[model samples]
Target: MDVDTEINELGISNTVDEIHGAHRIGQFERLKTSHTGRETLKRLGYHLHDTMHATTHEIPDWISRALKAPIPKNMNPTLHYGRRLDRCLNI
Candidate 1:
């Protein structure tokens, strides 16, 4: 018998399908705008930063640690906003 026939006879196809279905469901659930998604990303070492804002007073400590460069103490709001807009437009 060929490889496909052997896989079918052993029910490996069904097992593989089930695994893919489970993975898809897990991915969908994790993409929601909820704490579960945030926590999952955090566990994977992805820290969120408020790149849209110029003020640094409210930045979380975790963000500082995650960044390679030191977070600026203060930034010009207009410059920050312009940069954000440029990034969005380019993307």
Candidate 2:
């Protein structure tokens, strides 16, 4: 039998749809994580230094809110993390 016939006989056509659906869900999850993970990582203070190096100038609004400070006029907004962390550590 052909592939379609074999798949139908095995009642596995739904499996293909399920796999595609799972892939779409995974894509959405990855997008969400990529967008939100930075803020989450910063909040927990796990790897602030590394993240500062990796981040760009386009600071997301959520990050500013999370940091409870406005983004500076400089190109590298992430540099502010040092002073922010210092204040937090001092308190």
Measured by lDDT, the strongest candidate is 1
Q: Where does candidate 1 clash, by residue pair?
A: none
RMSD of each: 14.8, 16.6
User: Model 2 segments beyond 4 Å from truth?
Assistant: 1-3, 12-16, 36-91
Tens-place lDDT per residue, model 1, 1-91, is: 8998898898756777788999977875564446567666668776655442234377799997887975566554566797878888999
TM-score of each: 0.26, 0.27
Q: Which candidate number maximizes TM-score?
A: 2
Per-candidate total of colliding backbone pairs: 0, 0
Error of 2 at 84 (Å): 36
lDDT of 1 at 41: 60
Write down the worst ten-residue block by lDDT for model 1: 47-56
Candidate 1 has an lDDT of: 0.69
C-alpha local distance difference test of each model? 0.69, 0.66
Q: Extract clashing residue pairs from model 2.
A: none
**Model 1, runs deviating above 4 Å:** 13-19, 36-91
In model 1, the Cα lDDT at residue 26 comes to: 88
